[model samples]
Target: MTSASLGMAHTSSQAAILDVIRAAGTISRVELTRATGLTGATISTVVRRLINEGLVLEVGRAESTGGKPRMLLQLDPTARFAIGVHLDHAGITYVVSNLGGAIVTRWRQPGAGSDSPAEVVARIVREIGGMIARTGIDRSRVLGLGVVSPGPITAAVGMVLTPPSMESWTEYPLAEALEDGVGVPVLLDNDATASAVGEYWAGGIEPTSAFAALYMGTGIGAGVLVNGTVYRGASSNSGEIGHICVDIDGPPCWCGSRGCVEILAGPAAVVTAARAAGLDVGPAERSVAESFAAVARAALRGEPTAAAILQRSARYLAVAAHTLANIMDLDLVVLTGPSFALAGSLYLPAVEDLLSTAFFARQSHPVRVTISTNASDSAAVGAAALVLQSELAPRQSGARLQAELGPEPVPAQGRTSVVGSLG
Candidate 1:
């Protein structure tokens, strides 16, 4: 092989080694060599390079088998940082994480309803700066930002096309705008995909696990994962489950469809149902999130009307889950996002019981349905994990778009130094 090809191969191996070390949390050189199936010499070389790059740190020694104690190495959480921003119609979730996907800082702010797209971009840039300052992380060590928005996204263009509920952001160049404003390569994906990636990074699911993360935010979507990689359908909107027609005669959805799961079973639908059932869901002007929370609280307190409304929604979700399970033959279904934080208990059992008893693969295998273990800020965490995944294990998340489209052009005013390219 040519020297250049060998060098490229070495770089790929190094990335793989870095991913393994990050996954292992803390591992010795021998274990790394075993995990990567690389020669001890190659492992030593890669470890030395990573150490020099400040990406890996040598911690205390591990117990020796026979000879002297073996040195333990781990990803230096301080070596690099990533920012994740989750944009919603109601609020924004921003999280800063290290290379290990640990949340060093997290913030929640007003949503797009409070500001225009341009204003939101400016706010994100300013907030990101403050987060870095507060965390005392060097600017250069910050990798890049991953922005997760409601989808039907044209992933190739980083455009957020007509999302169901976030209509004000129609056809917005959110990724480009944020990149120009922040001077960081920005990755854009749907909430479902981000939450699924978060699940992968959280390490509860196995590497080869096939599961679906059904993200319930203002709208609903699915992130399908097969063998650890999200199955981004053509146009990267694979998980728009909310638009799946669960009832042909159901209410009209903002997506211009009738009887979409979103229109029938989304938070709005649930809140509406509760209100129609004579449950005092506060004032009609209350935000959908607040109304949904009220309904969930009532349901948890055994209000029959509220419980019945959520059950109806869960039944529709079960229909969607059945279709997803059959199509993907998934082993698990994870309900994630801020909406689920309050009402997952009501959704989980209904979906789980339906799938377990009547799923397409029921006779063959049971499809487990559960809420995300990290439900508090999964989308934000997933957004940060997107950066870690793109930088250290790009292949796993299929984040090679930058190589295809080239670096995004950074605007002039308020231009900051570019972190490593991630788009």
Candidate 2:
């Protein structure tokens, strides 16, 4: 074969070997050949290339079945790093992580709001630079930045398409601005999508299982993982659970809906209810954290009023969970986000009870509900996972890429649908 043909063959062999190592997590050259359908000579050639590139490392010796022990090859997680940023109405969280998504360093900044796009990008770039310096990771090893913001987002071009909570951030060229500021590629995804990816990576869920992540924060969002892949709908806004109306005419939501989940059970909703009960709730945003903590403290001390408010929020959340389960036929539900840390205990039991009773698949199998282990930082970590996935396992780009680059911008529209009886 010609030199060019030989090079192409070697590249294919290297890709195959890398695929085996990623799938096995750790495996010997003999095992890699068996897993990848590559010959022993091909595996040896590819493994040397991988080691030379610092992408794979010989960790230890694996036990042999009936032959000499072989050196185990594993992905060099520390060989590269990625930065993940979670942009929320409450705060902005930054995490620098290795290829495996283990956070090496973290930083927090004020959340995105009425600030100009340039201002927000500048702050993010400053924080990222500081984090990179502190971590001492070579700039060349840095993959890119993954920014997770609340929906609706255009994942393809990385734009924030007028999320309800941050009205001033409409039609923001978020990814381009951040990339220009930081001088690196920036991937923007919905916070819920990031949370789901984070859960998949850090939460120890089986990679092939279908799971739904309900992220409760300033607003509610859901992330649907179908067979280990995030399922973004036609407009990259599949999991807009906040606008799922539980009460038809109860209260007005900023999204122009009445008695939507966001209006009924978001942090603002809980604080409003608490104040109406004469609890002296402070500012809508600041008081949310303080008020929820007070309520959690009071409830732990057996205060009925605070406990009742928490229960009410949980009940509403349970309704949404049930609705989501019915629509998606999901078996596992993960509750995550800062709001979960505040009111998880209250939300978990109520959600479990409702799912057990009213889930559409209750007769066939039990729906499992659990809080995300890294509840407060799921989105941030998932943002990191976005970078890892882009580097490791990018999806086939056909219609998805075209849709991402199309001229039609995502409309700032919200919908409310009552799935079933709330009771």
Candidate 3:
């Protein structure tokens, strides 16, 4: 952020070094050299540049092996900052995270509801301004903003593939609109992928870990991370787990698939089942998110009907999770998103049980399942990490984070194109 005093790393080698130090928590120069398989001279040179740039700090010292104590180094948590916002029909979440992926500020706001794209954009701009002012962090320290939502983001057609409750946003030039209003670079991503990166960036998962972030908001999706990089499949649509068919003869899905996890076990399905079971989930006028939350709360409160419906959905979800794990051979699967925040207690065990018992790799290495520490705000936190990742850790996936939002949606008449590729 302080380019004159703390120039940003410009090479993959430098990014790799920063990532290693951050992931290690603290490592000596010798360890970095060994870990990276780089020459001592190269490690020294890169670490020196990082130290000079204020990205790395020489911490105390490590035990010596019949020699002088080795100096240890670490990422400076306060060195830089980034913003993340998760846009969903349930609620909008905002978070500010430092270089170490520690969230410094967070808040929530009403979902888009029936608001127009322009109005929502204005509110997002206003909310970010207030949030930054409240945190009191220097603007110069912030790398930029990252925004996540459901996909496939057919920006070319000006709409989310599965439209969030904010149907009016179907034709919005979201990235360009936000950047213009916020006066900062804005990157876009799907919530599931953002959650995956958020977990990796937070250093909870190992740097080379292979994991999937199973996110459930208004809809369900998953994001996979291989090593530390997002395993974006061809066309950046690697984690559309919601479309995985769990039952061949079940209900139809908008994705043109019969018995997809989305149609059979997503929040809408859960809520619909609840109502059909003669349970009072919520008011008819309430949002689908609200209805689903009612069911979750009731299930937690020992309502037999609600629990039955929710557990059924959880089982369907687990079926999908099992399928995904088998295909990816993942080491971990994290349940995250606003919906999970409300009923993860019910879903966690279902997913865990299935993976532990049915995962193909169970005989070799047991798969792990856990809820995201920032579950309710996982997407937003990940979005914030997007800025940090783009600038510091970059990516081995070829495209920089800022340019990885699939395609730039065609902007409305009189407006610039949505931010992607061209940006």
lDDT values of the candidates? 0.77, 0.72, 0.79
Pairs with steric clashes in candidate 2: none
Using all chains and alpha carbons, the TM-scores for the candidates as numbered come to: 0.90, 0.84, 0.89
Query: Where is model 3 more than 4 Å wrong at Cα?
Result: 1-11, 154-160, 402-423
Candidate 2 lDDT, tens digit per residue, 301-358?
A: 7778878988888888889889989988888999998889767877899999999988
- Top of the candidates by lDDT: 3
Provide the clashing-pair count of each candidate structure: 0, 0, 1
lDDT for model 2 comes to 0.72
Which residue pairs does candidate 1 place in steric collision?
A: none
Q: Can you tell me which runs of candidate 2 are displaced by over 4 Å? A: 1-24, 29-49, 155-165, 283-287, 397-423
State the lDDT of candidate 1 residue by residue for 175-198, as single tens digits: 767776776767777778889988
Tell me which of candidates 2 and 3 scores higher on lDDT. Answer: 3
